[model samples]
Target: MTMIHAPSGPNLEQVRRIVTEIPGPRSRELAARRSSALPAGLVSGSDVYVRAAGGAVVVDVDGNSFIDFGSGIAVTTVGNSAPRVVERVIQQLDSFTHTCFLATPYELYLAVAEELNALTPGDHVKRTALFNTGSEAVENAVKYARAFTGRPSVVTFDHAFHGRTLMTMTMTAKNRPYKQSFGPFAPEVYRAPMPYPYRSPGGADEAFAQFELLVDNQLGADSIACVIVEPILGEGGVIVPPSGFLKRIADACRDRGIVFVADEVQTGIARTGAWFASEHEGIVPDLVVTAKGLAGGLPLGAVTGRAEIMDAAPTGGIGGTYSGNPVSCAAALAVLDTIREEGLIDRAQQIGSKMSSELNSIAAATEVIGDVRGRGAMIAIELVLPGTHIPDPDATARVNRYCQARGLLTLTAGTYGNVLRFLPPLSISDDLLAEGLGILRDAIAVL
Candidate 1:
């Protein structure tokens, strides 16, 4: 296995020289073209138009280097333009770009699936199907679950984000933006209150009760095919559910013959200090949805599950035209090799500890930081009114603007829109991470 090092070519100094302003003039021009050319629905957080990226810095079209804390919204774990990834992608391009697996199966696709089966939690014989996005993987998980169990209903947690596809949109809980006018969503999807320690009234016990009621009183355990949830809510504000929440959910799903689907889209591929978030609880979910970081920086998604369940769907019933594209598989293989060779999983743990301690210290100085919580490199700080815990979404907005102005890319999440999430590349330099945190602290001080 070869480790991916921050490329020596185009070093940080050269990167800065090329890109200087936040969304430099070229980026602004591109943004104007995008606004005129694309649909309004493809909204972006900031107008930082990127031209190139590697390690922890993204050089926008304008010639400025910004410490990327979002990782292109948690996609590029090994960092954009990871050496090994770029090399493999270039090699794949030389061979062939697209040979749809369903039409003409390829060895690389099977090799990628084999890697997923071996890496995903569980010693059981697992099967994997590759797709283009996290949403498609999630949607297929449900399809397999329903097909395997012959059950129609699926349960998802509140504040959960599955995808933009019709079935997944119904599974998603947020309404304002994701599901607003996309109603008439797929039927048979039910919502359960998430074990959000910050907002849940009676803690995990109450959440469990709600789950049981939804199963026994509303949908019935026998009728439900799967229980899907994000190990740590991603777009819902980097919320870490109670310690035993996942264990309880897994147990209930097991007893009821329902599949426990772990939506690890944003948390998978060593982002959470572990290969998979379920490892934190020592629980092996029936299905795991992986994407974002899986291919280093390529478009790849996967659903790895127990063989019996995965095989239930008839042959030719579950594949996509471009599922398991060869080039993405090559990139995924390099990603796996890079994580193992570079020891990134444990590094994520160390990075989380460093960030948590520093962020907590910063929080103590201000009353606006209502909560700071997360696992591994995936961390967040929720803003609130100084006296009351009422969400201060505006303050969060201000912090984002401030950070962007100072050559740092930050992201905001949470249902109430008051949370600032830090999804920096796991391989970010120590000085850069600390520097970004300092900038964050200074921004908070001014607010």
Candidate 2:
């Protein structure tokens, strides 16, 4: 795919101006109210209450315009309140809101399935099942894999995050926030090593060997049902596996008759400059799960895979009351249209190129940044102690706060919590992008 340097357009002012302290008076009030009304377990990265968001800017209640680098945790890929999405959602709302697709089938649901089946990797006869969240779709995919293979064991990779549900949390490797205390997780799930470019010298051969060892010992070939992994590890600090590693695993799974599942929840929908991150590795998974940005800002997840595998489940096996809400389906169709018509596939790569270049320049000047890595708009900087690879979560927190205070919204991730990840919307203008990068540079300078 081609990477274009020029930005196509934006939905809001490119300027980011801070008129007050980070969490201004209005936000403080909201926080106080939230403390009483909501559970303290619900954590927010920023104290600023978002009043409005457009393009790559999230305006707070105190009128602070913060450059958005998180994209609402990789949602709103088409930009918040995208014109097409708004229009379609409004039209759908005017007609009907919740006719539950399972009880009363709608054309919107079928249209979304068609779009996903056509767009996802591979030319096989594909089928799609939509749900309200990524975790649900992933669980269904697991169920389908078990049913199709008649096997009990399922496998996920290290530093991988599938979802917050019981089964997916078991799939996730992180423990503190996602899995801590959420115990008694689903059984028959196994963990394997994913190739980490910065941490592992394995590249592809070592990754393959690890997989072979895992299959041979922990999980017998005949007992294993499927192996699910992200093409690029998302919350695990935007970890991009080495070249050929993904393809090697895919080939192995194919040969072993074990279904290969690609959890593209965080890296799909043109965020990585491709329709799906699997396209980057030229690997066609048996089942691919997608969410986060699928329905613009609306909640939606789709599991698209080979028709035979998806059809393995019973007729009433995988579905829910709000599986495919009409409004969300309409928003998803619009999101797909925006990506296709506006050439976001190439735009995403362009954003990545620009961010990677800028981030590399920063890394050259400081020891705080140990590695600069990612593909397309999904990028990250792994923070470390000066002159060493030891994780520095405190530094990560400090830098994140600096950016937010200076009117730039950034996010932190990774197993060690030392990664500053960037997920700007594909529509971010060149000026805003540069400004956000400048803020990041200044923040790192202080660190």
Candidate 3:
């Protein structure tokens, strides 16, 4: 089947066909070269090396085409090599790649900043500062919020994955690979309980109550500069909190004069049906940090917030040399336009409904999936010990490998590592979705 292609790219056969072994010969050769040239610490999702990709399919070096369910960890939300992004970048390259936005400003930078300020949740006079990655955006947002509130404390939650930078790694809750010996972490960062409805024995309501009490009693709202949270925890396993939980958090932050930041790095840019995951809760954050899908597949991130809070930073307090590279800014502009012009926001909702229903059906017949949750295309299934809530990381690993070998890309997440997260591109065809989900069902059946 010629799966529905995005506006442009290679004319690839959309079917997931494996012409050779999973890694194939060329990939194995590259792996040997990579081991010596690259650090062993750098982890990769699958063994296949992508030669070309577009829409929901990636052609490996061996000419094997796999269904791209991961979307490069949600960076390719507009789909890889999207025509608009490609055209915009090419046009920018014909003029200039970078003059450094700080040294000699450019129109693309202003255009992107304008787009962000208008597109993000609040209608209040807002300002946006662009960055190169999610970690930089998170760190910059924290610095500016502290500048505005005159407070030192920052609050995050358990089971949160902010990013891999120094300050962000400090904010992140996972320790094994993301943290480990990287500490001497930044100080004054506090952790609240995540309202995980599936794993929390006491339930989401009680967990939120604890979160409120902890912030009020221990951290003290007066000391908090900001409370940063993922509207739907992405790396922590696509955990969707209880309804109204996010709104209450927003309410508390507003009441205390605290800057509430929605770390929409993974959930923003229509990955969750709405423009942002925070919008799904009707919670307009004081600060919204965005990345991932923002630049199609390029590295671009931004921190947008109320004008007063954002302008508190000193003139030179934030911004890097390549923060808003012209090429990346061009791609981001195209990303916003594509999402608007192609109706991908509604597409995400449609994909989510189908995936969620199918996963629920699989859960109904199996003892492995303890829970199925998440909004839009960002969904996951928590594997657990049969008839119990105990995590089953081993089973999660087995299923991931099973899918990977069979031409399906999947990711493993969660604190306990028992959650298999799915982040398929919204541009994926219904036929490919059915075929990929069928492979997933077969993987679970053997487990």
Q: List the residue pairs that clash in candidate 1.
A: 18-63, 19-63, 19-64, 20-63, 20-64
lDDT of 3 by residue, 1-447 (tens): 122223225355567888889888888888898999998899697888777788789887877888988999999898888889889999989999889888999889889989989988878999999999999999999999999999999999999999999899999999988999898999999998887888664476777788789788988889999999999999998988888888988898899899999999999999999999998999999999999999988899999999999999998888899999999999999999999999999999999999999999999999999999999999999999999999999999999999988999999999999999999988899999998999999999999
TM-score of candidate 1 versus the correct structure, residues matched by position: 0.96
Q: Which stretches of candidate 3 lie over 4 Å from their true place?
A: 1-10
Candidate 2 per-residue lDDT over residues 132-182, each given as its tens digit? 999999998999999999999998998999889899999999998998888
lDDT of 2: 0.90
Query: lDDT of each prediction vs. the true structure?
Result: 0.88, 0.90, 0.90
Q: How close is candidate 2 to the true structure, as a TM-score?
A: 0.96
Better of 1 and 2 by TM-score: 2
Model 3 is weakest, by summed lDDT over 10 consecutive residues, at 1-10
Off by over 4 Å in 1: 1-21
The true-versus-predicted C-alpha distance at residue 46 of model 1, in Å, is 1.5
TM-scores of all candidate predictions against the true structure: 0.96, 0.96, 0.97
Instruction: Please report how far candidate 2 places residue 324 from its true position, in Å.
Output: 1.1
